[model samples]
Target: MNKIERIGVYTSGGDAPGMNAAIRAVVRTALYNGIKVTGIYRGYEGMIEGDFKEMVSRSVSSILQKGGTILKSARCAEFRTPEGRQKAYDQVKAAGIDALVAIGGDGTFTGAELFSKEFDIPVMCIPGTIDNDLYGSDYTLGFDTANNTVIDAIDKIKDTAASHNRLFFVEVMGRDSGCIALNAGVAGGAEALMLPEKDTAIEELIDSLEEARERNKTSMIVIVAEGDKNGGAYNVAKRVKEKFDFYDTKVSILGHLQRGGSPSSFDRVLATRMGYFAVNELIRGNRSATVGIRGSQIVSTSLEEALRGKELKLDEELLKIAQVMNI
Candidate 1:
C-alpha cells in the first residue's frame, strides 16, 4: 500500500471517541496488506510492562463507532524518564515490531520519538486526542466529535441560563492550546470568549456584561479555556460574582464529556482514511512521522518537524467574527 509486519499499536494519553475506530482501521488495513498487528494496552506503560495481545480481524469487529479506545490509554510518567523509555525500547525489540504506531496527544508523540530514536525502530505518531492541540495540523482526529459534544452541552446549558436570567461561564478543555474553547465559543454563540493567548481581565468582562445587561440582555454566557490565566470558568464565575451583586453565574466544565461519545461522521471517515494511510505509509518504509490532516488531505510530517513547537495561535479572523456576531 510493504515492510510493517507484526506492527505494534498503542494509544497513550487520554482516551477519545475515534481511537477505537482508528485502531480498527489500522488493524484491518494492515491485515488486508498481509501484516500482523498487536494492540498494546494502557499505552507506553503497557508497552514497557509488556502487556500486549494479538489483535485479530475479530478483535475490533464492532468498534468502528465506539466512544472509548479499545486499547485503552494512560499517561506513562515512568516512560518519560530515560530509564523507563529505555525499557520501552527494549520491549519493542523484544516484541519484534518492524514499525510502531502510537496514537495519542503531544506527549505521546514525544515519547514515540524518543523510543524511535533510541531503538532505531520506526514509530508513527497518530493524532488521536480530543484536545486538538497538536501542531502541524488544522485538526486532530477526535476534534469534530469533541466540538459537537461541546456544542450540544452549551445548547443545553443555554436553556437553563436564559430561564434563570443568569450568566453562564462554560469551561472547555484546551489546557495550553485553547482550540476547544475557541471553536466551541464560536459554535455555541458565547457572549464572550477567553483563551490562553490573551489575559483574562476581569474588568473587561465586567464591562462587557454591564453593557450587555444595560442593553436588555438579561442572560449572558461566556466560554473560557481551562488554561486561561484567571483559571477555569468556575473561577471566572466566582470573580464575576464577587465584582457585582449578581451572584447567579454558573460554571460548567465540559471536562471529559467531550472526550467520549460516538465518533462523529467526520471523525469516523477521517480515522478510517488515516488508518488506511498509516499502514500504507509504513509499508512504503516511512517512519518517525506523524500523519495529520492538512486542509483536505492526509499528509506526513517527520516527528522532528512536528515536535519543533507549533504553538497554538488563535485565529484573529475568528476573533473578528466573534466580535461582529457579538458572541
Candidate 2:
C-alpha cells in the first residue's frame, strides 16, 4: 500500500534467547523479497540516536543458534515522550525506512504502536520476552528456551537436594506473570509452585510441606515466580524454615540464567515462523499488529487488542497436573 522499499527492525525491552533467530528470519525474509533492511541498534534509544546499519543476509548468518538479539535492546523512557517520538520519526524518515519489524515484548509493542500512529507507518511486532506474558501470542520467542534452562538447573538442584535431603526454594523470573513458574514447575517436578496469579499463603505452603514430610519425603523443591505476593523465594524459604524445620532449606534465584541459552528446536522454529509471517504481513500492507502462532497457525492481531493487558488464563489443566503429580 505504501509502495514499500526499505524496512527497519529493532529489539527493545528485556532480551530473550530466540531473538537472534527471529532477527535472522526477518533479515533473510525481507532480503529474499528484494526489500532493503536496516538494523536499528539498542531499540528506540538507538533509533533516536540514529544508530543504524544496513543489514545483509550475511549479517544474520550463523546466528540462528545464538541467544539474545543481534540488534540489541534497551529501555528508552525518552521515547515515551512526544518530543522523543518526533525525533525517532524524523530519523526513520531520513533513513528511508518506510515500515518496521519490531521484536520484543509489550513495551516494544506499545512504542511501535504509538510511533506508527504518530507517523502513519507500518509496524509489525514479534513477541520476544522469556516471560511469555504477551496476550496475542500463545508462546513468546524465548519461553521454551527459558523453560529448558530452568528445568536444567532444577534437575541439577534436585540431585543435590536428594543427596543432602534438603528443601530448595527456587525463584524464577516472570515479573507479573506466572507462565514461567507454572510451566517450569511442572516440567521440573517441583513439589509446590507459588504464582502471582493466585494467593499462595505461607500457611498453605507450610501445610503442604508438612504433608510431604509425613509421607517420608526427604527432599522438596518449590518453584516461586518472581511476582509471588509472598515475596520471593528467599522470603518464602525464610518463613517456611521458621515453622517447618523438617529439612535444611536453601534458596536459589535463577535470575538472568533463564534468559540465556541456545534456544530449543521449538523456540527456533517458532521465531523463524513469526519473523517470516511478520515480514509477509508488512509486504501485504498489514501494519500496527503483531504476528503470533495460535494452535499451530500463524495469525495477526492488532496492537490495540494486544496492549489491552488481557491476561492469558492460567493453565488450569497444568495446575491440576502439578497438584496430582505432587501426590
Candidate 3:
C-alpha cells in the first residue's frame, strides 16, 4: 500500500456529542504521526463538493468539551450514486488525501466501505452514533452523553410527576435499538419500560402500571423507546388512560432533546481513544476497518465484519433487572 501522506476526516449522519472530540483526536493524531490532516466538512457532500480545509493542531483546540461535531454532519443522497462517488474520488485525489477517518454510525460506515473499495483508498471508521446499536462495540461515541441527557430529563420530569400525582410517558430516541431507553429508564428508576427489542403489549403495560398503583406509588414514569412495537409514548399514554385513569397523564416526547448535550466524561474519553486508534490504524496500512472498544481494549474490526447484519441483542440481564425493579 502507498504510504499514507494525508488523511481526510469527516462526520456524517445525525450529530452526536463527543464527535468533536473524535475529530480532535483524529486531527491531532494524524499531525502527531507526521501526516497532514484535512477536515472534510459536511461528510460525503463535502468530499464531493471539494469543501476541504487544512487542519492544524490548534484547529481543534478547546473543542474537546464541545457538543456536536466542529466538522458538522449531513445526509448525502448523492453519495449513494456511483457518479457522485466518482466526483468525490476526483476531489479527494486532487486534495492529496491518501487515507480517511470516517466518524459516524452505520450509514457513514457503509459509504466509507463503498468509497474505499471502489477507489482503493484506506479508510477507518469510528462508531459515533448515540444509539449504541453497532455490533462490534460495547459503547458508541455519544451513547453515554445521550443516556445522561435522558436521565436528567427523566429526573426533572419525575419531580413534577410526583408533585401532581401524574403518570408520565417519557419518549426517548432509539428508532432501532433500545439502549438509550433501557439505560436511562433503569437509571431514572422508571416504573416500566417499553423497548424496541421487546414486544410490549398495551394490556401488559397497563398491568404493570396497575401493579405500581396498587403498591401505592404516587408518581409513575414509563420510559418508552421511539420504536416500541406498541407505537410511541403518546399512543401508549392514550391506551393506558382508556383503561386506567387513576392519575393525571402526561406525555413528554424528548425528541431531539436527547441528541444534544455536553458529552459525559465517559463519552469524551471513549471518543478520544477511538479517534486516536483510527488514525494510527490507517497509518499502519489497514485499508478499511472500524475502531471500537471491547472490554476496555481498543480493537479494530474489518469493515465488512463490523457492518455485517449481525443482530445486536439487548442486554437480557439488564432487561430482567429493569422488569424486576419496576415492582
**Residue-level lDDT tens digits of model 3 in 159-182:** 999999999999999999999999
RMSD of each: 1.7, 0.8, 0.8
lDDT of 2: 0.93
- To one decimal, what is the Cα RMSD in angstroms of model 3 from the true structure? 0.8
Q: Clashes in each model (backbone N, CA, C under 3 Å)?
A: 1, 0, 0
The pairs that clash in candidate 3 are none
For model 2, residues 194-269, the per-residue Cα lDDT tens digits are: 9999998999999999999889999999999999999999999999999988899999999998998799999999
- TM-scores for candidates 1 onward, in order: 0.96, 0.99, 0.99
- The sequence of per-residue lDDT tens digits that candidate 1 reaches over residues 1-327 is 235668999898888778888899899999998898888999999998989899899999989889988788887789978999888778777887778888888889998888888878877778988878788777888999999999999999989989999888888888787778878888888889888888969989898888778778778889998889998887888888888646377888778888889999999988887788888888888878988888999998899989896666888898888877772
Give stretches of model 3 more than 4 Å off.
none
Q: Which run of 10 residues does model 2 get worst, by summed lDDT?
A: 306-315
Winner by TM-score between candidate 2 and candidate 1: 2
TM-score of 2: 0.99
The alpha-carbon deviation from the true structure for residue 277 of candidate 1, after best TM-score superposition, in angstroms, is 1.1
